[model samples]
Target: MADNNNYRDTTHQSDLSISITPAKAGVGLLFAGGALTMHRILCLSALLMGLFSAVGVYAADAQQSEPVDPGIEGSAIDKSAKEKSDSGGSSFAVWESKYFASSPDNTGPAVEQPIEFPHFRHAGDHDKGGMEINCMYCHTYARRSLVAGIPPVQKCVGCHQSIESVRDKPRIKKLFEYWDAKKAIPWKKVHDLPDFVRFSHERHIQRFIFQLNRPVQEVCGYCHGDVKTMTVARRQKLLSMGFCVTCHEVKHPVTAEGGTPIGDQAYWYSMRKPIIDASGIIKAQGPNDCSVCHK
Candidate 1:
């Protein structure tokens, strides 16, 4: 009986040891699973933070790279408005000359014969042979002086002196006669600004030529229009006082149509209106202060 009881006690002890081993194994597995899940959560949080930081940096760089658009804020509105008021009447009339009479005496010889000079015809290109010279070669002072000078009889004679038998045209013959008589040719002024206004060829040329680095041909066209195509030069631009003021106020270096640079040509830099037509003739009103212009 003692032997059988000892055997039963040993068997019970073995069974208890087996059960404890399985419980220990399950607890170890649960702890490992919790640790792995925590590590994965931390890795995911770090990745999300890195992505957010990258996006923020990209946004800042984009803003800095953008270009600034200059608004039309610095304009002289008052001067412009006044110009519009003055030019409101007789928008089409050229210079208001005192000598101009509406009607001439019918009995008298036709005093002013219209010079039927076709600007387009002479400027056109022909298939057989034709060469066009720029207007500035003859009207050299247009870009450098306030008034574009008409070619003197001497200048015409420089070329005409050599050419013979081409005196059929009255204007050409008249030019030669003026040269022979040592008299100045009386060419009608086609475009004249008002007396009170001040305009500068030097300023425009300097800004466009020296500062902006524009070619002469392109710069001259701003006022003269395409002289290459015109036979008889007419007033191409309205050249109104308001037109001058508008250009001053907007402060664009070049007209928007041409991608020309206005650069330092902006009026504010000069501290005075550079161009004015105040005298009612193409009157330009520079800055209002006396010191602005006189000083």
Candidate 2:
């Protein structure tokens, strides 16, 4: 009987030990799992740090690259002229190159338009069988508005309907189809800037055209290349920050000594107010403030 009682006591103790074993094992497993998770997190952080360091080095190399000059890259102006002519336009006209930078490398991809408007026929030199129409005649808003808005269909129809010359032309026929459909032609934007950038065509037009009394073509050529020679308008200038900054750094006479009045003082204010000199001349460069272009 004592032997049987001792056997029962041993069985009970064994059951109790078996029940407690899982709880101790669970605590140990939880600690081990946490250590493994921490190790994985540290490895991930090191990988991310390595990736960021590589990006920093690449950005540094890009920053050290040579700067682009506003002027065309050539030993002589004649060579530069030949380069421009070979790209798409005629021989280098000083009017086209005067205020803007032009290079074959800077030309943008040719964009396909809904109706291939013949700019060369309309705005090119009169000697080349062109009408020699002023740019402002079609793009009327450049002087007053922020954007040089596209002309309405009616504007084109007004002249085209009256003139029978080239009415049967394929491009003109496509234009007429849009007019008959009573739908606006979805002309693709050729020169597009980032959403963050704010450019005022009105401000530039006013300064270069009205205030400076520069030829409209020369002034417009500062951003857009010689459009007169192109069949369809294409981006010919770089239109980058470097291009703009290069032009802005060069000092321009604010008022050309009774040539054109600056008009309202408030209208001419850009990043900073212009300073008048002892010779009664207002000479200043373009707005260089970050807030001016970054808006």
Candidate 3:
């Protein structure tokens, strides 16, 4: 009887140990799951806080007024508005000039370039510090290509290397740095047109500069503004459909002063063919048809 009782006691002790072991494992699992849940909640809270902070910062920035940089000129809207008001033009005139004139926003935002090339120093009038370099000398492709190609770095260094006077200048130093590194000066395009718009710099250059014999500066100015006076080039003209259409609608003289008829020297798209009016003067209009430009 004593042996049997001892055997029963050992079995009961073993069973109790097994039951307690399972309870402890269940408690541990519960604690681990709770901890995981708490961690996820904390992470979600942090993400929300970050998102809210970003939104608040954006709102604050949106409300704040942008400070004008002295180096950059004011937008065309501001200049035209003031000019119209000064001239005693009506509000409608001011509105029209601001939106529909040569450019809606002349002199666009100043694009920060690798080197701040001083257009005034290079292209400005001889009375000023400008070298009076011809536009064609650097932009050689304007008359020959669809796009006015950016000049290679070698072209700039070729001339700059000989000019020892301004070699030490900061801008020139930067130019040399790029040359030494064998990198192209990444010029930012200020007059960026939309991808869909088709513009042929060659056609315009051939017609105005070669055939019409218009001043290079004046012809370029019709779209680029007075870049000769600019430090860094900016979009001085609007280049909008309205600006283009306005010029196209007008009937311009087909011949230059010497009566050199604007024959099919260059393929120019026009709504109507060159016509001889009652005054015996040949006149041609620019492309007014959608297909001529849209394609």
Please write out the lDDT profile of model 2 over residues 1-295, one tens digit for every residue. Answer: 1111111111122233344455545544555555555787765655555455545544433432223232321122233323333442321233224333455556667789899889989888899988989899998999899788899999999999987988899988988999999889888887787777788899889977898677787678668768899988988776777566544533322332332334644335442334455555553434534567778
Query: Model 3: number of clashes?
Result: 1
Q: Which ten-residue region of model 2 has the weakest summed lDDT? A: 1-10
| Candidate lDDT values, in order | 0.46, 0.61, 0.60
Better of 1 and 3 by lDDT: 3
What clash count goes with each model? 20, 0, 1
Which residue runs of candidate 2 sit more than 4 Å off their true CA positions?
A: 1-105, 252-285
Give one digit per residue, the lDDT tens place, for model 1 in 1-295: 1111111112112233344444554554555555555787665555554455445444433433332222222233323323332433322121211112222321122223234444444344454233445556677786778666777767778976776766677867776677778987655666666666677777777776668766555566566545556555655554664444434533432222211225625433332333322432221223433332232
Q: Please, what is the TM-score per model?
A: 0.44, 0.56, 0.56
What's model 2's TM-score?
A: 0.56
On the 0 to 100 scale, the lDDT of residue 65 in model 1 is 30
- Model 3 ranges off by over 4 Å: 1-107, 252-285
- Tell me the lDDT of model 1 at 21: 49
Better TM-score candidate (1, 3): 3
